[model samples]
Target: MRQPVTLSSRGFARAMRADATKAETLLWQALRNRQLNGLKFKRQVPLDGYILDFVCFEAGLIIEVDGSQHADSQADVVRDRHFEEQGFHILRFWNDEVEKNPDAVCSAILQAAKGRG
Candidate 1:
C-alpha cells in the first residue's frame, strides 16, 4: 500500500508550489489546465515522501526540472530508481533546457506520455 503523506510534507509541497523557480513557472504555464495534449498535471505534489515537480498520475509520469546542483547527485539517482521501481517514468530537463526551448520539451513530454500509453 502507498504510505500516507504527512502534514509537514504537504506544507512543504505547498511552499514549493508558491516559490517555484522561473523554469518551473514557464513549464507550468505551458502544462497547466490540460494545455499540453489534454493531459492533467499537478505541480509540487507530495508523493511517497518526495515532492515531485510535476506529475501526471494517470500517465505514471514525473517531470523534474533540475539545476546545476543536481549534477552527479547520488540522492537523485536513488530517488529515480525508487520511482522507476514503482513503474513511474521520470523525465528530467535542465533549467536552461526548459527555458530555452519549451516547445521541444513539451514535444518530448508528449512523446513520452504517448509512448507509455
Candidate 2:
C-alpha cells in the first residue's frame, strides 16, 4: 500500500483553515497529537487525488465527515467500496452528530479502530 506524501507546513495550515465541516473539526480535536488512545492522526490528508477528513495510519482508518450531501446512500456505498478496495476502513459521521453528541461519535471511531467490523 502506498501512503501519500505529507503536505508542506504552509499547505497543511492552509488546508486546516479552509472551511472545515463541523464533524471534521470535532474529530480533529479528538485525534490530534495522540489524543485518542495515543494514536496519531492527520486531517485533510491527501490520499491519491482526494483528501480524507481524518486518518490514523497506525489503525488504517479514514474518517469522512459527511453532511446532507451524502443523503444518497447508493453513491455513498459505491464510494465506500472504492475506499475499502484501497485498504481503507471508512467511518462516516453526520455533522449534527458530531456537534450534538461528539462523545458518541468518538466512541464509534474508537470501536472501529478495534476492528469491530
lDDT of 1 by residue, 6-117 (tens): 9999999999999999999999999999999989999999988999999998888999999999999999999999999999999999999999999999999998999665
Q: Runs in model 1 with CA error above 4 Å?
A: none
Candidate 2 lDDT over 1-117, as tens digits, reads: 655565664376466648786667777888888888777788876665456778888788888888887887796787678778977799988888888998998889888888632
Clashing pairs in 2: none
Clashes of each: 0, 0
- RMSD each, Å: 0.8, 3.6
The TM-score between candidate 1 and the true structure equals 0.97
Please provide TM-scores, in order, for all candidate models, with all chains considered together: 0.97, 0.79
